[model samples]
Target: MIQTGQSIPEVVVQQITPKGIEKTDTVSLFGTGKTVLFAVPGAFTPTCSEQHLPGFVQHFDEFRRQGYDVACMAVNDPFVMQAWMKSAGVPDGMRMVADGNAELARALGLELDASAYGMGIRSKRFAMLIQDGAVKQLFVEAPGEFRVSTAEHMLEAIAG
Candidate 1:
């Protein structure tokens, strides 16, 4: 697991936009300014859809007010990410990034294998407060835990 004060890995991810598909690197994603990046194990999974992503979606405005560019990533294809965003009612503030081959997850050293649950090579559920492409704070969950490292928690961390 990558820690705070470490530079984020230079990993390229596929951005699925209504316009089309495009490639973007991690620096490109977080370079504009401070960014709040959260990763989930899988797209459309119960916890991700019902809680994790929705927490971010609901608190996106607050995150933006605190000067953070918000993004969500998963180890799934671009098309699936796009569809899941729609189904989950993702708001405009949150950008959905696709780590199609788990490259980004691997680069972050946050990759997880969930073969028993039928998910192969997925990202762990974690959130990081990154500034200028470097990690400022990291909140990673233990397997199946979702209380901390949430959008609300990250917001509080930013506030304090």
Candidate 2:
């Protein structure tokens, strides 16, 4: 798994744009600023929809005030992610990123095999603070758990 001070992999991540789905390198998204990034197992899942994502959206302005750009990533396509954002009423402060094919998830060593559950490979729940292209802090949840990798937890870590 990627650790503190390690550079994130330069993989392609897609997001919805006015014209259509636009693709960009992962580094470009989390590489340059004090970035707050959280990953969920999948979009629209029970915990993710009801809790994980909402927490971030609620704290989005606070994260920005703390000098961070917040984003949520999933192992879903950009279209699905966009739809999820609308469905969940996610605010503009939080951007949705698609790691389709698990590219970034695999590079971070956070891929969870869920074939038995018919979900294939998905990202493990995680939140991290990235600064100037390097990881400053990372909180990866235990299997099927969601205790640490939360917006509040990340904010607390950042405050300290």
Candidate 3:
């Protein structure tokens, strides 16, 4: 997994919008500003939709208040991401990114295989605090665990 002070991999992501899908590079998505890049195992999955993503959604205002642009990435297709965000009631501040091929996950060294659970190659559940396009802090969950690395924790990290 990526660590603090390391430069994250520059990868392309597809953004699903009401009109259509748009391709965007990581540098463009992250830009030269503070960002919170959170990755989930899958879109619309039990924990991801109910807990992980919603945690960020619920605290999105606080994140922005602390001066961070937020983005969520998953290994699903752009269409799936779009529907998931709508169904999950994602807030306005969070941008959903589709990494359909796992390229970004592999580049970040956070890819996880969940074939036993019927999920293909996917990103591990994690979140990072990035500043000026460089990683400043990383919060990665143990497999099948959800607690730390949540939006609340990241909010505290931002505060401290």
Candidate 4:
């Protein structure tokens, strides 16, 4: 797993934009400023659609007010991510990352072997605070648990 003080790996990723799918790199995405990057196993999964993503959407302003850029990453493709963003009514403050091949997850050492679940390789539920290319804090949830990585928890953690 990526430890605090370590720089985020430079891996190319994709995101769905108004124009089309845009290719971007992790360094440019999370390296330049304070970023709250949250990951889910897959897009449209129950917990992810109901709680995980919504929590971030609800507290997005709080994060932004504190000058943190919020982003969501999933192992799904850009098309799925874009659909989820629209369906969830995600605000403009949040950026969606499509880790289709789990490249970023593997780089962070946060990949989950979910083949048994028929999901193939996916990202574990986690959140990280990255500042100026280095990780400041990391909250990785235990398997089948939702606690530390929630937006509310992250807000409290950051405040402290």
Candidate 5:
């Protein structure tokens, strides 16, 4: 997996925005400043919709106030990702990445084989603290667990 101090991989991904779906690369999306990019196994899944993504939504302002751009990525289509964020009431400017082909996950070596569950290839649940395109800190959750990658945990991580 990509480690701390490693730069974010250069891969083109799609982002959902008010204007329309836009193509963006990791460097352009996360290269400018501090960013907290959290990945979900899939959009609208139980834990993701109920807890993981909500934690970040609830603390969106806090992350921004601390000089960090917040982004959520999922191995779902741009349309579904946009719908999920809308259903979750995400604020404007919060980025929603659509890793439709699992390109980013595979590149980061964080792909999860969930074929048994019929979910196909998906991203492992994790969060990364990035600065100027390099990973500064990373929190990856164990399979079926939801502790380390939450927004509350990330807040504490940056605070200290």
Candidate 6:
């Protein structure tokens, strides 16, 4: 996995917006300041829907107040990301990124092959604190494990 202090590779990821999905990249998203990026294996999956995403939405303000642009990413199409965002009630303060081709995830070395579990290549569940495009902290969950990447954990980490 890409380690702390490394600049995120340049890759195009999509962001779902009211107008439509738009292509965005790490430089545009995190180049100017701090960003809190969290990734899920898939959108609308149980854990992702019930916990992972909600945690970020719930803590979006705290993250912003702490000077972070929080975004949720998944290896899903922009349409799916849009629907999931609506269903998840993603706040305006938060953003959803579509790693449709897993490009960004692969660049971060956080891509996962879940063929045995019936899913194809996906982004591993993970989170990172990036400052001006460089990783400051990275928390990647072991397969099927959810820790370290939780919003509470990040909040606690940032608080201290």
Report every candidate's CA lDDT.
0.89, 0.89, 0.88, 0.94, 0.96, 0.90
Task: Give lDDT: candidate 6, residue 132.
Answer: 88
Candidate 4 lDDT tens digits, 20-117: 68999988897788999999999999999999999999999999999999999999999999999999989985899999999999999999999999
Clashing residue pairs, candidate 1? Answer: none
**So what's the TM-score on candidate 3?**
0.95
lDDT of 5 by residue, 1-160 (tens): 9999999999999999988799989999998799999999999999999999999999999999999999999999999998998999998889999999999999999999999999999999999999999999999999989999999999999997
**After superposing candidate 2, which stretches have Cα over 4 Å from the reference?**
none
Off by over 4 Å in 4: none
lDDT of 2 by residue, 50-134 (tens): 9999999888889999999988999998989988988888876577899989999999999999899999999999999999888
Number of the top TM-score candidate: 5
> Clash number for every model?
0, 0, 0, 0, 0, 0
Candidate 6's residue-wise lDDT over 1-160, tens digit each? 8999999898988988777789888788878788889999999899999999999989898899998889899999999999999998988858789999899989899999988889899999999888888999999999779998999988987777
RMSD of each: 1.1, 1.1, 1.2, 0.7, 0.5, 0.9
Clashing pairs in 4: none
* Cα-based TM-score, every candidate: 0.96, 0.96, 0.95, 0.98, 0.99, 0.97
Ten contiguous residues minimizing lDDT sum, candidate 4: 15-24
Which candidate achieves the best lDDT against the true structure? Answer: 5
Of candidates 6 and 1, the better by lDDT? 6
lDDT of 5 at 62: 97
Give the range of the ten consecutive residues with the poorest summed lDDT in model 6.
Answer: 17-26
